[model samples]
Target: MNDFTPSRRSFLAGSAAAGASLVIGLNAKGALAAGHDGALVPNPFVKIAPDGTVTVIIKHFEMGQGTTTGLATLVAEEMDADWDALQIEFAPADASKYANTLFGMQGTGGSTAMANSYMQYRQAGAAARAMLMEAASLEWAVRASEITIDKGVVRHGDVSAGFGELVGKVKETAEPPSEPILKEPKDFKLIGQDLLPRKDTPAKTDGTAIFAMDVAPEGAIYAVMARAPRFGGTVASLDDSAALEVPGVSAVKETPKGVVVYATDTWAAMQGRDALSIEWDFSNAEGRSTEEMEAEYAAALDGDGPVARDDAGVAEALETGTAVEAEFDFPFLAHAPMETMNCVVQAKDGKVHIWDGSQFPTVTQMAVGAVTGVGPENTSIETVYAGGSFGRRANMDSDYHVEAAMAAIALGTDQPVKLVWTREDDVRGGYYRPMVKHRVKMAVGADGKLAAWQSDVASKSIFTGTPMEEMIVHDGVDHSTVEGVSDTQYAIPAMKVSVRNMETPVPVLWWRSVGHSHSGYAMEVAMDMAAEAAGADPVAFREELLAGSPRLLGVLKLAAEKAGWGNDLPDGWGRGVAVHPSFNSYVAQVAEVSTDADGRVKLERIVAAVDCGVAVNPDVIRAQVEGAIGYGLSHAMRQKITLDSGEVVQSNFPDYEPLRINDMPKIEVHIVASAEAPTGIGEPGLPPAAPAVANAIFAATGKRIMRLPMVDAGVEFA
Candidate 1:
């Protein structure tokens, strides 16, 4: 696909030619910086064109998450610019300019896109408006304070001019402000509006938006690798005689991961890969089945592990009070995005150029540079729209990108190569959500209230062996393994949480909501059980315990009210509710479900209430919450990645099914009004869904589902 961003086409060209444009740059600390030729250097984040078009550079990748739209709204609202004149472009691989403040790296995950960059982009817009006002003041012989900009036009009393007319003067005379005053929430026009159209919807609906899969360089070749069936197995030997005979096949080479087949096109490459014969070694491969792993994980829960959190007197409280015990099992899961993993790499003259749905451009640049003998400064990445990547594509090791770089280097030619992972490859590929087991024992005090809570969690650690080990692992505990449990919002007086990180060859990574996926399920289900033991309404019990947490209590109350918690349902129908906080956002979900005589569940409706602090875009937030509900239900209902002696059991959507459209429940999202800083909505809406549904099933059938992917627990969802 052709380069969609005006960054390379006009922004850079305008700067080089000193055209009629005003460019404002931001420094590392968000202060104003100079552009090219003693003027403000084009920071690539903000550009004001002579035609009144305002383009904002987005550092986060858009993966059907509406991140592009959310970030652009910040600029348009702060600048008082016309919404139709706004544009968005993905930032290039420059960590110094675009690093995520939360991670100190250039990446987009953990729903931190909006949270971390909210002020940065707002400041960019405010600064641009300041410069434009200053230029208009100079032209009209009025004080800067007397000038005002509204909808791409500057006016001072009777004098009026479009922003396009002041571009030349702003470039020559206006000075960039280090601290630009931002508009308050009350003065906002587009920030909270639900009718504003998304910038990407036009191109996406017209099929003109560039995705990584759509890029095909002039002389690029297609590459397909024949990897080991099981994880940790390497190539022992390969015979490429038949592969070479295949039409359009050029060469077959061996890399650390697998043997690669290079062809003139994807079809020929796939055919050549199938024709090649390879022998695998299982010396260090995972040989155990999922059943065996589950047994081991369950056993680990019996032992006292590293303490993630400890409140006072939890053991004695459990011994003295009435104990309510439960165990929940969650299986490994695949991301299974619509567009599979693919990237194009070109390495020539000690410079590497990559085109991909780059979630972490800084890491990809470094990984590819290391392989191609090109330094970081010589490597460049062009980000494109990704179909979806719940948590894939942001690999800490840059797996697929390095594989393509190695393939390009192995060819020893200038021909660019596009590495493609077929649907089977994408599904069977590892880095799954770690299989986890949670065992909880809750106690009711003499007052008949939730008193003490103790939880033992066992799972493979996602950050222990990766580059994030030093950052995420603390005091022998992988925090990601026990997030929702350790940092729960519920006001449990006496609580103790311990975690055991099981060593395994099966690679694990953070799924949507990370640890909250399983932790929230266990925590909320235990809450329901505790409520029953106390002989209190589930909503009332939670409200009492959550008295200290206003946001959590607020959403829970809102969701209960919206779902008609006290209303009578049909004989077979039941209502269940759960509230959770993750990524600084609180979400509560209430699920209404009914079960047939055969114990098959039909989820009828879901009511969700979220307080993400100052809803930037209510429409996008609603869409995200609705979409998260479906994604969460898909995994809780039917999806899991199991192994039969180290080989993935399910290959595609047929066997590893997603939620069907016919089974989708009626979803209603309600957003709380708040003026606080905006938090993340991407992953927070997901953690509460499964638990609410599970709780609803219990209310309906009087049966507890201890195991996940309800199919395995003899419970099916319709």
Candidate 2:
């Protein structure tokens, strides 16, 4: 066996664990009994048991993003371990043990799990592999390099040892590799391969998946809240006599913002809340309609707002008789995940425990701990599967989680009480995407090259009143609202971008793609307009303007080539293109659309090219791209949430409809292979779709669409 020497520190670390107690148990006669111990490990990603079983604990909650599978891929790749023999489990509430490397909290959002934890998990796998290899080498009396590993077996020519047989001899004497040699792309056997279905897919499809709503502890009660109709409004008084008369109605409590109705079941709680008579104090400031907010935003554009980006001599370029100006309007939007907002909490013995399908568990735990005067460590958060969270589950203040915890504490109930918000409640809830207005002015030189560009955006700051309000905004300009506009790819000599943060009584939060959603639309549409004014094809014009950006130009050319950009189409069909670079990745899209005789818009196909660099799983990346296209088309065609006197006009699917199957277009995705590090894919596909469709609309009808929900503006597809 090779002499595997250990450092003094490693030996001392192992010696310190000599007093640790190990427990082993068996269920029936031969059935395996799950082991549980109070002792916690710092890196709980993997645990080796005495019985030859390997358990991998995942910290992030899975919500259809395939995080569990992706994390496992990282572990398996570095460990050179047998994937079929590994067992996966969810980690317990231990923030210190599994702190997020990116945000320093135990949560999942921003499409960061795979990209941030890739190396960390790989190192974990390498550590375990080293220990196992050393043990096997010792047993066989051969050098570690002579022992080849495959399918959980270490072999030396005629001799072989299973990982289970070597576990007892494999002392934990190996240190994590500081710079482990990562596997080459060509050597990846399972990462990009389409393996079997995900571990949770069957359970989810069969309705056996345990979401927060399905988590009902024994003797648990239910509660429904009647929040203020207008945000920031408070409840004056509640007449609970009618609610008490209902069968199974238990009690009603008045909270800071509203009244909570407690009952035996969810139906009873909802019915009791409906029966209660409550008066709201909205006299301080009546809520304004969406139209009023849009007008205010439009008026704010005329004022001198904070300049996010300004180049020298933009005014002189505008006066050079080559300037073009246009305006774009983006409406407010809702997350509208499949599962509504819900949280189950139980507060007792100076401690609080919560089971929630939240994206920001650490944030929720901290918020609950601070409000109830409990220690942060004492607050336990159990994450469940979220049906969907497009940045909705990671609210800045943990509004839903705090409200649920407060309700449970106020009730003083030993049983866990779940607070469920109805679909209507979710729709009218405070947080929403801010309505924005964009004014863009650009100049093209005599050579048909982009010379100067100017843009001003007016919108309510999403972070103004949140925890990150102070960190992201400087001099009254919210950087989130002008991200894509300020960092555009064109090689303009002079440019200026301003953002006006308009104050609104309504609450606003981050939606999918965040500021890039509106900024990309404005930028791309403005580019298309400039191209049209210069009497050039959109694809060729963008290529000319992108002379300084080879990466963006490459993707644009690929997308155009894939979509047959220069080829002729049907008489009524037209093509449009858009490109956006965000989150360190570049994406380009070409949309083919046609309008029927009745003016109905029909999106025939979409060609997307992405340069995200070395996709770990190309199929999944393509799926995300297709999904983004569908979502973008929904918003472009008919998805919007309007308000009338602080009340949401569209409540359900009948009005706030998503894209139907017939409305979906055929999508083709192309990935540009590179040796560079991988970038994000979840949100990169979103920014290009809206402008591509809008540009196509202009091509069909010779009309410029400045507003969203194209159907509302008499935009016909034919």
Candidate 3:
């Protein structure tokens, strides 16, 4: 991916270098620019030199989302390009050249890349193919309709010419049709098929994946920081005399928030950082703990705040005797990606280069450029595949990158400096999913149906202070905070929802499903309770509420059918179902669970059905659903990050335990086929799992556990 904007001269130069005889005029943007004009183009332009070699530039950063292969498929499909002869390269960070339409930014998130770019990339491919076909038709003196393209070659009867051979003669032609006919889905030979893993699988299996830890630049020193233990607490002072005396330790620098220890390698840096003595500022804590935050959140729910949505007289309805009230609590959660946080940076000759496994490479580049007082053009960001992101890598606080860049400058060495955050640092350093409390009141009519609903959600705004805050938050309501609930498909006569922003010192971010994680739990659990109150089957109850939504009803019916919703299960085992629409996709899940005599609950199976329009790759879609169920179940079962005196208490896997293979459930995924453009699959599957599991637990034990980590509610699993 050449991030550089291509000037006309550079475009011609590049084409010539590839031995392409065609005179290619670049868009007005300079070569390597991310945005072309005002539009984002993450697809790379390929040029075949007269020498027959192909170069492909990719715009989206590759971070294990299979963007590399997905984007490549679009180009190959359109170009009729020879896959074996083409080489792929990374695009540079230039927002002007590669803005994402879904985010209106130059990066990937929200699972919108594939769906958004599906058509644009195909058009790019079709244009290239048209040119080659025309060139072959001209040479063969045959009608263009008689020409066919296959593997980078244009064929007319027995005559054929490679794309490279036709490039020179095809230059300066009018642009191909803007709305070229797309290949029929049935005719797709590559788009929906499983592609051989291209980049990471081999590297990881062979232990050569260049994660941040593996980035060892020449003369690269190591730096470690002793950051504030408590959120928003700055370091008062540091005693680095002993740290400087440690073997291989070179220098110690004081930062605004912490002390940095520089050494020859990571081990030395770790030793020096440990030996350094630092004075803490506990003033920011004010004795606030998780219990205190929980109380504050509960208090806010009772007071007036911002009204996000109001459709009817919810207050009057809730005030009547026919209403059911329930409160659900979700604790703060840590991203806890396996790789932790680390960045390697080098500053030399007014140029900054960085190597990091970040989900937000453009943001990282912009932050580095801003902090170093350099132009964005002067910075280079190289993205490596992250072990896992789950939104942690999308940090607005570029603490790791800033520390490394500053250390490199302070050390006065052209050598790169790698700053690593230990597992403890990563855990204790802020940026957690906001803890949330929901107070819900629903009015049930004598007819056993919901008449009106009122919900008050209290939580620290995930968007209040981040770069994405303005775009995601409006009218004092963070849409990310009420996704599943606000856009619920259920048909209630009236509904009122309000959000009270709880200002807390803890830094929060959008975790995987964002608000859907907790909001889905609260909404679905409430729905299940309503169903039980109505004396109706859960599936039938949901179907009645979702009468008008065909897509929702479709998934709901499919999931229930697959889970054998009405069939009798073994004694003590119960089934629960939940449906949600997010990221343009509708998902429904049914969880089967059993409770032992001693009250231990075990989730045995999960049946998932998704209507994501068209399934570009059914296998990948199923894999995503399975992965989300596993992740969602982990959070539902025991994943939580508790704060003690404003500091995270869970430091590693031992404390924040995720599910293991032994706890794996039998997962069945069904994709509802449609011709509608593909919607997201990455995070949508997650929102329904927790609620489905909770609903199942309620069926098994007749207990409506309102709090998360069912463990917290004393709902133990065997």
- lDDT string for model 2 (1-718, tens) is 1111223343233223222211111112212112244211113476666555566677677776777666776667666667777666666655555555555556677667666666667666655566677778888888988877776677889988776677666433333333445667687766666543465666789998889878898788899899887776778877999999889889999876478899999899999998999988877644789888888888888888899989998888788837799988888887888888898888888888889876876667667776666755678888878888778888856778777877786787767888998888887764778888999998877877777899989988886655455567877778889988887888778999998888766667887788998888999989998897787889988898798998899999999999998899887777889999877788999998888887777898899999987666677778778887888788888878877887668776778788899989889999998767666777789889989988877786677778887876778543
Candidate 1 per-residue C-alpha lDDT over 335-365 given as tens digits, one digit per residue, 9 for 90 to 100 = 8899999999998887999999999877676
**Candidate 1 Cα errors over 4 Å, as ranges:** 1-43, 171-173
Native-to-model Cα distance after best TM-score fit, residue 324 in candidate 2, in Å:
1.7
TM-score of 1: 0.94
Query: What's model 2's lDDT at 647?
Result: 67
Note the Cα lDDT for every prediction shown.
0.85, 0.76, 0.76
lDDT of 3 at 386: 69
| Residue 469 in candidate 1, Cα distance off native in Å | 1.5
Write the residue-wise lDDT of candidate 3 on 12-122 in tens digits: 332232221111213333232222322222224554555445555666666566666666677777777776666566666655545555554456678776777677666
Winner by TM-score: 1
Clashing pairs in 2: 1-141, 595-717, 595-718, 596-718, 599-716, 599-717, 600-717, 601-717
- Candidate 1 colliding pairs: 34-40, 34-41, 35-39, 35-40, 35-41, 36-41
On lDDT, the leading prediction is 1
